[model samples]
Target chain A: MSAENAAGTPPLLDVKNLSVRYPLRSGVVEAVRGVSFVLGRERLGIVGESGSGKSQTGRAILGLTPQPGIVAADRLRFDGIDLLSLPPREMRRLRGRRISMVMQDPKYSLNPVMTVGAQIVEACRVQKLAGGRAAKDRALDMLAAVKIDDPRRVFGLYPHELSGGMGQRAMIAMMLVGEPDLLIADEPTSALDVTIQLEVLKILDELVATRGMGLVFISHDLRLVASFCDRVLVMYGGRIVEEVAAARLGEAGHPYTRGLLGSAPRLSGSVHPLPVLERDPAWLA
Target chain B: MAVPTPPAAQHDRGLPAPPAGLKAWLTSPAPASRTQARLGRFYRGWRGFVRNPAAMAGFVIVLLLLVVAASADLIATHSPTVAGDLRTERLLPPGGEFWLGTDDQARDIWSRIVHGSRVTLVVVLLVSVISMPVGLAVGTVSGYAGGVVDAVLMRITDIFLAFPRLVLALAFVAALGPGIENAIIAIAITAWPPYARLARAEALQLRGADFIAAAKLQGASPLRIVAVHIVPMCMPSVIVRVTLDMAGVILIAAGLGFLGLGAQPPQPEWGAMVASGRRFLIDQWWVAAMPGAAIFIVSLGFNLLGDGLRDVLDPKAAER
Candidate 1:
């Protein structure tokens, strides 16, 4: 971490302590609790089960915690701009322009009525990046960049017309069109085929390497994160239970991390009835 | 989208050529250009609409109304309101120079009914134009904003919706003074609440949709999100409602005209003609019946077309 910090250059994103609470009729339900991390130009993965606050944490960074969800933090800064206190109008300019998040389920994330090219073009031109023809060309180029074989033909297709993997790639293209510094991908490849997943990861890898983009990859697949990201954050009970280098994930000291690791089905194992993760009350503390 | 045929499948001869001409061009599996794609979409919807015979009848009736309204001047032989030789021509049976017979004032009933199509068209167009936007904007904004805004806007919509449509329109016309323009305003005011309610329901479902969230992530403002994202989703339903409501609007216009609160003397409004001819109904049945039948057929046309449109345009019905 110390070796990667260049002199006089701030990290692309910095979070001191961020918490998100959804106030319900019953009571306030805390979704993310005191999670803090700094992201440079490298891939960071968040591994957690559903309802473990992983997706909410990513949403908080993008200021997209759906209405009625309250967010607070000591400091949430992106490229030196105070995200916690920035005016909404200013925040909007930064949101998809400097930072963007890829949502789960491309079927729902992409507009059903709009053709793929129009949506991608909208993503590019939303920041006043380009107009009409140039934005359209960039959209087609982005589609091709995402490894779509026939970009022009696919561009005119609607979201429902595309297969799952193609829809996911189209969504990724929409997010990356503006070349944001930080990209938070939430379960991006969960709907994809294994081969398509690898192809998509290769696209993400290329973007991170060539564009120096900071990535927050959130998925429950621990092994995939370990193989793909440089650093990994393990979340449980609305908090970060462990943080470790992707290479040393096998050597993680935390019990929860080990439990998750032990629970995954291994190719070499003859073990039946894979280990069920047990709850520890103290982890919430 | 076009896949190559396998050698074994060659017996099919490359999926037989599309249809003969226009249908072939319009329903092409892979449209060559944007215009073709749009037309293809429309052609498919048109085909769906053509399947229902009742809806086709209604569609034809509406088409006839439009043509008749547009060319009323050319179609009506005599002036709609001009009276001639009252003692000799008045209340003549359906024959000779007066196909639908003469009215109490010796005016041609057929000419008047033909000309009255223009009045109906104007009322329908003006009412929809004035009210659809207002209802859509209010309902969409309220639903998207939710919370206090939703409650307030909805309560206001409730107040408007509580009144019986014709009663509300009648009250408005009585206050604004009797005339066709005021009648249209009254009808428009009464017509929008149902649209608002429909739009609000649609917006509620769409407000939490992922595509809307995606638009927000793209930094689209609330106004843009509502206008661009939410409104389009709600449009199919709104359009269905508009078509359905056209019947109601026309009814209210006729009701107002019946009460003498719309389309004063010489206007040739069907309802106004009915009102005047009702006095002579015993001896001159066609005088009142012709205009009344016109009202029934036109209203039925709108209702049938509206129902058929739901099957073609409403996403829920379209899915079914």
Candidate 2:
């Protein structure tokens, strides 16, 4: 892939050693431990099972971890801007403008009372990208870009009025209207049907490529990641156990990655029992 | 190569024609005019209201009281404050001159009850208007801005809630001095704590909602998040609470008036009128009974309206 060949290009996001810890009465639980990865201006997928801290890793990048979640990193930078030490006011300016996140469930993520157009316009207005008629125009254009059949009609509809696929598309439209340089999509299509999922993926793939924006696609579906992304980072117990080119994912060296691949139910294979993932304490260490 | 068509009689044999009424009901078009659409909406709401007997009764009583309060000038046969000849009119039975009889002061009891609704309703409105915004702001700020801010605001709210509502209002009124305005201020001060508590609970629930997180990610300020996102979600329950609390506010204002701390005598305040008629309760029942009944009816109306509002506004109710 071109992303692999472009080795000399500087990474858009650089993380040396990042850790997220939550303190409890019992003890401090380390959700993410010494995780490090560099994201270039290409599609990079982070695949992991539930409790693997994949979502936390995405939230940590955007500084969206909830209260009592202590995020620590040796070096966390986005385009050489030190994210760790950036003031909240400056971080606010960078958040939706430079780096935007599309949450897991569009049903819960979009404001229920606000119209599709108003929400998109708010995203643009908050970033100072556009205002009033210009914002409305940009919002409509973004809606059309996301393949919404009737942008004008959909614009006035509330989130609950739209179906699951339409709501997800609206969310994407709202997030992308600001034209952020980097997008972190946390399980954006998990709540959708298979057919709708493919359509959403297509729109995302085209947008990422056309905008030349870096994408950190977080999900558990390995086959999808391999097909859609240029590179994949396999996370296990909050650590990056493997990193491989998406095309070369089948030949991954890590046992965990191999085990994940083996667990998938195949269409052509004989009816052998699926292998359960075996955990090793050393993986955590 | 010619295709054969099904006979028209064969097509008719396949299915029976639907009843005209059923067909009309199923295929009725949307309302043609804006006014028609509005009326349709109102009709649906009214139907839902009428389905609940208690709510309907409450609505009717509240509506009747509102009409009586609004049209006191037209309804009352005589001036509420003007006293008639004491020897001739005092303690007269319900008849020609005085419809509901006269007080010991020879003032028209019916006229006083009708005019007294104005004072009671004003108190209710003032208390609600004053308390709701104050409580909403307090609760939203406290709940949304959790941690030290939440801790401090909630502790203060707890202190206020610890005192019994009526006792607190009485104390405030006693300190602020007697009269309708002071009584309103007292009731407003006491009324807000419950709203704050309700709003705070709602805010806490909504503070962690995904939409709130999304707004934060969109670079919305704390104020904007609370105002635009948190407040609207919290308002439905708060409104229901306000409607319910209107009953209590009316009662409290009347209590203050009875104690001579609100709506001073000769002003036709319901509670003060009731107080004045106490001396002649046995001799002239209508004097106290008339205003007392008015108070009871108006309070009942507010309570029923509040209950109906809860049924209508609650999303959970629709689900059930």
Candidate 3:
């Protein structure tokens, strides 16, 4: 814990040489293989098709990899604290207060029985706030901060009462209440409408820029990531094959990234048959 | 000269605004369902049963029974044990002076039925309170923890449930040997396993829900999670089981009494009353009919309540 190391820390959260393997009944499945990344106070997006283990890498960083899944890393640091060494109790304390996560679907992520305000208040109460009113005020402020109209009404409503877009916004409000150093948004806006998706992304962008919180945006769409994130990690077969700046995603050299770009339909471009992804057997190996 | 006005002014302006009225307030959309709203719904559903005609009728009958039981001092002319009062009238039928007739002891049968309700209700409520928590805790731990814990606990529940409840109660009474307290203990031991099994099944389903994960993520203590989330979520099923089991406890307690292990001597339990009256069925049908009817009413009350509550509380049932 040198002063220089703390001052010049590469990023708020730095994960180096991480590997995770799950022991199933049949055999071991390597979910992540030597994945490495640095997350500064900028949006970093990981884009991969399903089963590519992009989610596993994010989970491994937060020590949330499910049971029977072995998570190992040479270095997993969050604001100079060694993440892998923390006990379960301390890790739980860190989860919502310091390094919060916005899970993929609000429908599954939120507690259906809990009111949006209570859920947000519960998150704020994780760190033991002053009192009930303070927690409630903070929860309402967060709902308003996420650009929710009629925050008072929305706060009292249950998850089932909300539309998909409102649910995601409420979830974002809950995650960002503590203003964590790093916010890992796992498909945060996937369930939202196109208009609401832009609104949510804009709110996320504003929060990240204002608070200087590092973000790891996980998604399958490279185009959205390209426009929204600062740096992009193209994951294929649980490995980070190509890393490029957001604007330079068009010039990405890897065949998988090229395939992903080509597969996505363009609005203005004259259409022929869409490009099918060419599989490389070596990629699996 | 008339002047053209803006669209906004045409709708409202140029004159003083109309005062807000009750109609405006009534027409406003409801504010949202908060914790208070959820609690209000629960209370409304709970009170709805109180308003049911059958339950209300049963409640009145049960209440009258309780009043008779409680006023034994003024109601009963003589002690229950003073059998064959040779000087006084015997087997007096319902009349102006006798009022539902005199028993073999010349004690009022109606007064005894009232007092008998107090005893039955006490035993039923006591046994229920004691066993419900025991079943809920053991069942919740087994189901929610799963794996080894579930196997071990469920095996114990299986062993208890393997024996017939009456047989188990008889054995328990034989071990303790006679009296109302012993009967209650016997019934409590025999009755708890069903509740435990039901609660376990409920907890198993609730443990997998997203709220549990959400609670965990919020760093809620395990005890708080169990008390607040797990228990409340499983309560509807557990409560229905409780209502059903309460009737079972009352029947078992009465069975113990009939077997000569409950309410010794002059305590005047309904079961003992029926047992004593069985020999004189042809001569004294009222004695047997009265206490037998008490048992029937109690068990019927619980069964009907359990059925109604199960329907009202179960969301899946509502869907069907």
Top-scoring candidate (lDDT) = 1
Give the winner by lDDT: 2 or 3: 2
Task: Return the clash pairs for model 1, or none.
Answer: none
Name the Cα RMSD for model 3: 6.6
lDDT of 3 by residue, A95-158 (tens): 7778877877788778776789988887777667535999999999999998998999999888
Candidate DockQ values, in order, are 0.71, 0.71, 0.43
Candidate 2 residues B1-320, lDDT tens each? 12232342133333333223422323325533333445556666676788989888888888888898899999999999999998888888789888888888888888988898888888998999999999999999999999999999989999989998888988998898988999999999988988899999999998898988888788877888898888888888888999999988988888888888888878999898888888888877787888788888888888988988788777588557
Tell me how many residue pairs clash in candidate 3.
2
lDDT of 1 at B54: 85
Which ranges of candidate 3 are over 4 A from the true structure?
A: A1-6, B1-86, B89-96, B173-186, B262-265, B318-320
- Candidate 3 is graded, for docking, as acceptable
Q: Cα deviation in Å at residue B319, candidate 1?
A: 8.0
| Model 2: residues with Cα > 4 Å off, grouped in runs | A1-10, B1-45, B315-320
User: In terms of docking quality, how is candidate 1 classified?
Assistant: medium
RMSD of 2: 5.8
TM-scores, each model vs. reference: 0.92, 0.90, 0.83
